[model samples]
Target: MDPFVVVVLSLSFLLLLSLWRQSSGRRNLPPGPTPLPIIGNFHLIDMKNTRQSFSNFSKTYGPVYTLYFGSQPTVVLYGYEALKEALIDHGEEFSGRGSFPMLEKVFKGKGIAFSNGNVWKAKRLFTVNTLRNLGMGRRTIEEKVQEEAQWLVKELKKTNGSPYDPHFIMGCAPCNVICSIIFQNRFDYEDKDFLSLIGKVNECSKILTTPECQENGNQQTIYSLDHLASLVTGLFFAGTESTGTTMRCALLLLLKHPHITAKVQEEIDHVIGRHRRPSMQDRIHMPYTNAMVHEVQRYADIAPNSMVHEMTCDTKFRNYFLPKGTTVIASLTSVLQDSKEFPNPEMFDPAHFLDGNGNFKKSDYFMPFSTGKRVCVGQSLASMELFLFLTTILQNFKLKPLVDPKDIDITPIGSIFSTIPPTFQMCFIPI
Candidate 1:
């Protein structure tokens, strides 16, 4: 029981532990900041600004590096080169969704967004085919979007040039669109059940919004109550929340840059004419408006890091060995904001998606929805809704910020889960 003996034994044990970790870390895993015993490199993270902190780490450790959250080692993919390589080129090995405690608590890992293995494959195929059958790319879906856009414009007009926050007003249209697809019918915005469902989208818990399902065939038999609940909630969160937030960002950005807004309205008017609502076909002819929507998505850079991807098996990527079940984050923010791909990447410029000839330009790095085999299932539907909703609003209203355009802060508020637009009021005047 000698104190000196105890101290010497403790010191020796610590030395051995450090050596073991060093040997393991250097064997094949990507290099990163040395982690502490339990906390790992969590102390190195700037919780308030996660993307910037990750970018700073990339500067020190190159594009691919490891950061430990507690005992779990998470490999982060930075910039377009690294992101594209892992998510697209080597997709199969990196397609599995990692364990997310909060999402697991809600989804129970049953739906397409968070599920892996056979469950995910079955649900994804069913959902995609169902959406296609429901006319996702056809005029049937476009007509629904146009109808919601009309309702949105009607609601916005009620403000009568008053400065008001458009968050709920913006959200209702997208929420109903997803509702129609999932429940086979849309609810009135004023309906209590509809409002209650919208409020549950952000909660890290199960929602009680049930869809009316009819016994059809093998697919219906496979889809249990849990399956349907998870699917509906997953689609609601993905379909409603992200799309609504992006539209809010688009409007705020337009208000911040009135000249840009003017140009978009002009393009909409010239291409589609004021007498009718915009359509998917019109997206081709209205390059400038299309570019503006692209720019909004790029600038918002929502979902900076993708939902974690687990390595299906041990894989070698970019000359680094990633072990089986290793957690990976494809940083969408890094790709969208890469200066090489986008000149003045921080600036809100539609020219990023426009060619010198004024045509809508597509970039391999425009990955707001993430990419690869696991790209968002609602991609086509969300795109149609964003285009129609935004153009319709612009066609009918002039969004004037209460303050000077330069004074408006377009910097997003939330940093961890999403890069949300700051709260501000704008006067939606009828044109």
Candidate 2:
């Protein structure tokens, strides 16, 4: 062969080899919606309503679909089976919570919610045990809730059955409960620092739900005001807004379904009586109320998307490979709205948790708190707060709509990190 011909053939072979390597590198990634260069799929995300948009995307791309937002690759797990498999069945493989550069900057590894590995393990365990020791799931906690509820009732009564916004007042009540558990004290409604903290938290929540922040450019440092702002906002939004919104949803639902409300009141009145306050011990006996609370959680479906979980090490789910550092998000909304599991998922029916004989029935699919190791650290405390605040409020007063029920919009406002909760005026008519 000619020397020139041999050299030309070798150069062509090397060029083809380089192209093959590039194509193979792309193939190694999980399939996802086509992402734009640099931006990825950040443009496609509905930062305002992430759960709804992601749910719609999951329908098109199957349960385990990949999405790129900014430089991060996110694996979304839709529906009960997928979420359960990721968070429970193959939990260890998907246990690590995804760490964003901004989040690291804010948290600086202080709390249970964001920390990972042994640090997360120790913090979460300590937090949970501390809450329990503080009587979070017991009668002592109930007394605190009852005290707050009485104060709220007095405030509502002062409204003289006039229409009023309950969002701010209602929100502060539950945040105070968590504050008592964490800080060993509750905040008065007028306290300056307490109110300032709540304001900061609310602002942070708004920033989180907004799409504007995503355009702020990639941050490298682990701590910055932007990150801290987002972190505080996320904590307040998650800690207060979620539990509060669920209670609001429950109140609205009870008002619309008077018969159910009546039943709950009767049950509460029967077990605890009008003279005394309802206790946590009464939860088992007041099955209807327990079932109703569970239904509220299911229907409200707050935190539709569980916190994104990251793979600390290369892991495999069934045969699907999840590479190290891949972000996994469990869609709680899909699971709660599963038609197969809930029959009529859209309807707000308390019967979903009730048996033929009217006894409370626990369903395996009711996972509002999620599951596995990284499951909500506040689950036990949130449950106690929800049940106590809700039942106590209902026992003392009836939530009467100020206008036609149809005019009272339950549709959420604000961005998607947490439900903004609807704005409506109601008269808390004393029973």
Candidate 3:
């Protein structure tokens, strides 16, 4: 017998035994399509539409199911109830942050979004406190959002009803708001340094998959000065990206639905009027406008998968056991598009958030910033931003599409991570 053949047989036997053990170990996990070793269920996924793939998997596997991203078994909570149970009901148990490889290389497990255990809790607390100090969700922050909204309006006025590509302007407004919060000063839209920074922030998504983690002066470790840079980057990236994308998507949707846009403008006229900018106080009296904002978030459905979360401790949930550090996805797309909660959810209707009396109706399933213990730290800031910016724009200008409203495509040109509106030039016809 050849020794080479003997070695081959031994290796084959060991590999088979390891695979057998892997299959047997998954008995306690919920249930899903069986995964192949190594690549696991990568074959089961459409890499492009991963969230939709996860959502589709729910139809076959029911609400709670297991998937293997490589050898790691992931438990997905599909619909609203399952998500609420795991994320909110078992909040503490599921509070740990999970891995996003593209982000981990940059964050290095040092920041609020990706850090776990005590570091996560501390970082989160510090961030929340820092945001609060910077006037997040308060009247002070409202003023900042309003100021930016005014600046945005002024910038639009410069267009003088000419056709303009608003992509950069839309990004600049929210980016500056975050800049103020993080750096304590906003930049002029034309400033070269500010433009460069924005380029880096937007490029982070495009380039992160192959990101070379740049070295700074301090390279000690987590909690080191190098990590401090990662922390600020994490906050700045998150703060600007989602809010800006939502605003862009919301605007695109408005252009697509001229009648809906008319209604929102009508409400703005009736409540806040042109005399004053929309305020948080105005939000209560302006039910239709508020509903429109909420519906935009639901219908836009950016950040569909939300941030992946992890289990803090080994826990038995429902009939299956999820080990500590098990990655869990509470599908925001599933909850946002849940037909049960919002009738004809695929249609962009403000009535989904409105009642028979036309008052704003709150739905537990509206988790765009997501819900639970680890909900987006800037949720309040984002909400205020949406209302103020959207209303302000409508108050000053009527969004005129070059094509007919029916022809306008509201579909997001999304990447794996977030949604982006198609590149468009529109006439910001003054109201």
TM-score quality measure for candidate 3: 0.92
Superposed Cα deviation of residue 272, candidate 3 (Å): 1.9
RMSD of candidate 1 to the truth, in angstroms, is: 4.9
Model 3 clash count equals: 0
Report the C-alpha lDDT of model 3 over 1-431, residue by residue, as the tens digit: 99999999998998788678779878888898888878788888876667678878898999999888788888888898998998889999988888888768777787778877767766678778878877786787888888999999988999999989887888788888988887878888899998997887788755532212121222244456756777788877877777777788888888988899999888888888887878899999989889999998999888777778888899999978988888887788899998998999889999999889998899999999888988988888888888889999999998998898888877566544465667777989877
Off by over 4 Å in 3: 1-15, 207-224
Model 3's alpha-carbon lDDT is: 0.82
Error of 1 at 420 (Å): 1.0
Ranking by lDDT: 1, 3, 2
Off by over 4 Å in 1: 2-26, 204-222
Which regions in candidate 2 have their CA more than 4 angstroms from the true location? 1-26, 42-49, 100-105, 211-238, 414-416
Instruction: Kindly indicate the candidate among 1 and 2 with the higher TM-score.
Output: 1
lDDT of each: 0.83, 0.74, 0.82
The TM-scores of all predictions, comma-separated, are 0.92, 0.84, 0.92
Error of 1 at 212 (Å): 36
CA lDDT, candidate 1, residue 171: 81
